[model samples]
Target: MKKIIQNFGTIVLIFLSSFLFSQNTNSSFEIKNSSFLLNGKPFTIYSGEMHYPRVPQEYWKHRLQMMKAMGLNTVATYVFWNYHEESPGKWNFSGEKDLKKFIKTAQEVGLYVIIRPGPYVCAEWEFGGYPWWLQKNKNLEIRTDNKAFLDECEKYITQLTKQIVPLQIDHGGPIIMVQAENEFGSYVEQRKEISLEQHRKYSYKIKDMLLKHGITVPLFTSDSSFYFVGGSIKGALPTANGENNVDVLKKSVDEYHGGKGPYMVAEYYPGWLDHWAEPFVKVSTEDVVKQSEIYIKNGVSFNYYMIHGGTNFAFTSGANYDKNSDIQPDLTSYDYDAPISEAGWATPKYNALRNIFQKLNNNQLPEVSKPVKVISIPEFKITKTASLFDVIEGKKSIVNNQPVTFEDLNIGSGYILYRRIFEKDEKGKLEIKGLRDYATIYINKDFVGELNRINKKYDLDIEIKKGDQLDILVENMGRINYGSEINHNLKGIISPVKINESEISRNWQMFPLPFDEFLKHNFKTKNIPENVPVIQEAEFILDETGDTFLDTRNFGKGIVFINGKNLGRYWKVGPQQTLFVPGVWLKKGKNVIQIFEQLNSNETVKTIDHPILDQLNK
Candidate 1:
């Protein structure tokens, strides 16, 4: 009797093992006649765009689950070329920038993947994801037949393929399709069709390269909406962008492809991104719920452009092409007023979308978690102990050569300090042309000048008295937001050292931000100055990860970072005072906090529970 029972158990175990193996090895995805097959059957994709590098690691699972609960079956992401390779042979895939982990997590939550590995993706990212260092190469004309650019692109694609190729349908993964160079035809004029043909050639080249590296998924190109009218085959999946309106989606379907195949919305708008001076945008949750319902009812597969908008962090955010009237630099916080805010909280829009998805099906949704906690610290006083001159007294490099633009100097981002020694008895008009943004002039360490964008010129005329040396500091506040001239952006002293419209020949010393140097420098404040503010450092314990706003009411204009994560610029006088720290970057243990206060010796900071968007904007 015991032997009979054992035989039955063995049979059951064998059967279960066979079923699991079959499931893992099956290619449930299929493509036929330009339609997608989900689970070996035709299925329309409801997709959303959320780059893995944009959001933090801790929130990846939560954001993916949120999308699933919002009626989206797929998540679309962009593989930023420059992000993977910061310098020429160096690659980083850890922390918030981990792409493969993000994709696998999406699959774990029952969501398919559409990878847009753009060698050139103009998603409003800095230089469209091309490394800033690439621009330094003298013989490169980005997005063209530049050998250097193409060679780098190939290397990046090869490395990325190793991570994603195995995750395709044939390998029991969620990736269904990969997009070729995004929106190429939109920029090229006159020879639109010819440009598209060129795009097709490159698209196939990338496709072949990926296949060589073992990615066998179908490839497609997102064409210009106008060009498609001339019989251009837009993306293999018959994709249309910004098709938020139901009528427009239907019209686009019939007009573009004769309404034959699956209808898809490649880019759906739920909210908008705000600039530094712009008012905080509050999107209507009702509008999102209504539009989503309409899309689903009409059998249209749509994806939110940013269901979970995350921070642009560091120098990665790109500007819009609005008219050149405003200096609308892309702000550090890419909150976007999205369904899931940059900080990763489930906003009212998330809840509304979740309810709509639940109503559409009987699928039991995952439990929604509570928001993270935020703590505030008591006010502490800070005083400046040293000046720039005192610290780098003898180590400054003086430039006697020709003046170079910031771009010419190859200084892409951050602040640059320029100092020159002026004879005490000299007085003349100190005019500086081509200044990108802001600058401050000092005569013998006494502040005597200020220049801003509204002034529209870097030339400053000042009276120079005898017995004083001249020191000037400039900051690339941000490049002008719009227009063709953006590519020529430079930070410090574009056309330097001018007196009364004529150039002044003097020994000029340049100090490029010294970010790493500052980090390693030790404080040697043996005697406290009564009026100067001190650069302070402290440590804290974070029990949870959530959105945090650093209150910089007491500190002047400068930068702050917590646990090596940049919290953005803070100014005691200006429009944005509090910096938003996304919950995902915070850890539940000891963390480092460092600050470079501008002025006003007394520095007291605290982290508040709520976002300071409304308070700061108002």
Candidate 2:
């Protein structure tokens, strides 16, 4: 009996030892001139760019595992400054925006992490990742040698380092390389003095800051493969932002530093984003796969722009360009036609790449998980019981001296309204100082003119003929995405009123559309307004829960929500006619549906099953 008891204790000890061995006790990657030494040998990192904030929290693990199975040695992600720290001096690193879990998950799946911690990460994101609040002070210039901007940058970097420094390669984790300001080369020449100074100072300051926070990993700054006059071209690893065909990229990279080390396609375009009226732009998946294969075959490292393009939830979606033409804002659905679509479903591109990867690696890959099933919600009715303004009435308004900008009102990323009374024959050259995107001007009840912010000038001669009130309403289409144009994202009424080109600035009433208003308003529709605004609400019951689209054909422009998870903002003037609804955000019992249509019409919302890509023209 004594012998048997001793044998049993020994067996338990053996099992415990094996468990410890299976877990990653100590792992590291070494970065030499142009190569990564993973676990002691030279390695080429085939990576893909996917942001944690963009993808849902539930899908992070599955997406990372999928990336590993696709012959990717690393997962590249952007730690968007605006995402982690929404309010200034506040920070959140969990849930869909969990930066640490995302990194650990990559390590768990046997893949390295390449972190892009940009005070200015231009992932076609709103204000290029800089928080919109910074735009409040019109005099504050970002990415410059401005003391205030640098101070804020230091604070954000210090806080972020606390979360990630420990997970880097030198610390027995998967993060091999960290990128500085993203695509800085593209903006350097344009801003010349300010750009070069900020670039140099940011590089030196951030390195010191990280080192102070105990982050000892090697760092690189991604550029446009061009040598700058005074920038830290030597300190950074030479990389191309989006140039795909290796020959063009190689020539440019080689020319930068006499052709020394490993080549990296920092951003390889997989799919383009959609605008209000444009159809879904689908890239040839075959071509992308072929190009990737070519890059690997040629011994080059490339990261897909987005391996799993996710959603831009709420007003986080950004505008692309204002190049003297159409002012195009990106749609909420960030489904970049990537390997994994926005709804966490893998596409043919994912399968094709997985199969190719298997062929190259002798079938050494993890099991592929089944795709999440699509859900459909039956028609629901949401009566618009009260307008937003009616709910918040009688409360003392936060009146401003001038028509305050969204930033001035301490508001970021949403719709804003400016209402004022103009007596008859009050004529002036109405000028808006810094209108972000689109605005609807109304004299009495008739629409006067539409201002396009991309053009950068709004001068409409107004003669208040009848009533004693003029309503100047503006919708912040979106903040600018790329270039030095980021500083111009002051939403709402930026210089609201005007008098013959001279500013009519004083005693203006600004209305901030806070998120709370969605819940505070009494939503009973018995006493509806004669002229109903575009948006309305509805209710429905469902035995089974699933994903679907709340078709907006009957209504005009607005947003829809189910169970209060903002599906996304929708505009009736489309190509993208429907908004995506995730089944998990739905209920198995009764559900509440609300719509805020832009045009004046009353119609119950009808939801139909749809994919993220197929929502165009439907």
Candidate 3:
């Protein structure tokens, strides 16, 4: 009789799952009695977050496979708008930007997919993943009820959905759930520029847009428990973002879900993101294990916010602002101190969680894959160096009657030089009205001083002759990725120059130094002056191709390029000192290295096996 009853129970469970899975036509996912029913069976989703744009194309398969071996059934990713469409109407989905290939890879890896398609993904990315061109639309208000902003979002979603809708489970692919605009609750609460009604309209409008764009999968909104009021959709599931005391999490979702179940922590943060000067964030593995136990015991579904955080690479990093000081630019290496290291090595946390998850899965999890090879390159010497002034001899500059912004000139990333010949001999506190970030001030090609927006320093006392040239070389540190500050982020010298109380508002020669173009220009190699920008080049040989970190501790501030591909920013200022160089991007024989040093020189650079992401300013 006991045997018969046991068999009957198994059959009943299967029946329940099949019943729920078929009930919803739009989505096979359903909520029933505090459980997620998939194809008539209770399903617990164990997921991880990793961005495709963050990891190199060659490593996507490895990373997704690692996720499955670590006991994850699903992988969640955010489709960054700016990453796919850098400029207006310019769309790129091939190669690394191929969203379809990434999703297909996850499916091939035997894992489910949860896509967070954000017009605003706020992953500490430049301008919260909104393209720099969006700022050009003067009247467009982001994250609110604005026609221009919504119009662009609509067009973007339409373009993006073409990649997603084809891969949904109903269409015989792996994608199971889709997220509406990311964490709108936090934004609505923090932004005072928009009204509660306007914010509410904006949030729902995004959900509507997602539906309009043909995303047929289950839609959900993610925010902390306290933010459910502003972040949730009417018929869609509401999932919490950070910790919510299990009881609160279940209660919040139940209230919003018509007293249903299938409670999910959509973004369970295991570790934290490290900014440029901040301490390396390391969450205890033991604590994470404990939380996993609670979720399993309570019959909850959860996804690690970032099971793996790859490199930010290039100018993709973003800045954070506060009411007190200036912006805090994020580090290029987004290690996130996760279970899997940025270099794709299995960490202690990975082993610890694997043990727990294996037990939960009835010991069905696979063994963790071997890590990618990491090689240490011997120090390589510099081959050539060129002066910035000499390199820009023939480059044209916009002769503006008044100082303009990066967006006005369609210059996205890199540096901008604003030159002005002093009309007459004058000396006062020199100030740039809207210095976007950092500036290196020079008097007649002589380095005089430096100003940094991060320090909130704008003015410097200076004396100039009538014929003396005043040059302000400014770098667009990065744009704000979060909160109300995102609305005001504009690069370069945004406004007029000021001398104490007097304003200098005429005859500014603005030069856009897009480093991408510099590689094509013939640099007149010569002796460079001290404390000014210089382009340095070198060649290094490798017997085998593999992953490595280029140590930049010896160098000051600049960008690194290996074989003409950018490895991203490196500053002596602490937190991140090494940039990851993917093995796939290197040739076994010879590789060219380029460095645009805005500060001092380093005779040679060493490619080390380990990354130094915790170093502070020396």
lDDT leader: 3
State the lDDT of candidate 3 residue by residue for 1-618, as single tens digits.
996876577556545643543333444655566676665578899999999998999999999889977888899998889888867888999998999999888876777899998788899888998988888888998888889999999989999999999888777677888998888888878875677787888888989999987887788888888888777878678999986489999889888889877789998888888777667778899889899889888878899979999988888999899655578888888889888888888999988988988887676565577888888899878978877777777888899888888898888899888899877987989988589888999887788898888778889999998989988989987899988889898899887888877888678898888676344446555666788788888888889989999988888888988887888888888778889999889988989898988887668878889988877773
lDDT of 1 at 577: 56
lDDT of each: 0.65, 0.70, 0.84
Candidate 1 lDDT score at position 225: 49
lDDT of 2 by residue, 1-618 (tens): 996776576556534533442355475665566566666777787888788877667768878877866767788988888887879888988677678888887776667789888778877677788888877655667876677777788889888998888787767667888876666666766666565656666556655666577766666667655533333355556677666668876776666645665677877887777776567788888998888888879888888888888777767777877566436777878888888877767689988888878887666565576666666665655556564445445655566667777777787766666766644357767777566667766655456766656555566777775445566657777778777667666677665467576655555666666552354555545454443233455678888876566676666566666787776777655666667776777777777776565455555557676654444443
Instruction: Give all TM-scores, in the order shown.
Output: 0.84, 0.88, 0.94
Query: Each candidate's root-mean-square deviation in Å?
Result: 6.1, 5.7, 5.2
Regions more than 4 Å wrong, model 2: 1-22, 137-139, 193-198, 227-233, 251-259, 427-433, 443-450, 454-467, 499-506, 516-519, 524-535, 612-618
Question: What is the per-residue lDDT of model 1 for residues 393-454, given as tens digits with 9 covering 90 to 100?
Answer: 56656475434555655566666667666554566777766565566677766677676543
TM-score, cand. 2: 0.88
- Stretches off by above 4 angstroms in model 3 are 1-27, 521-525
Ranking by TM-score: 3, 2, 1
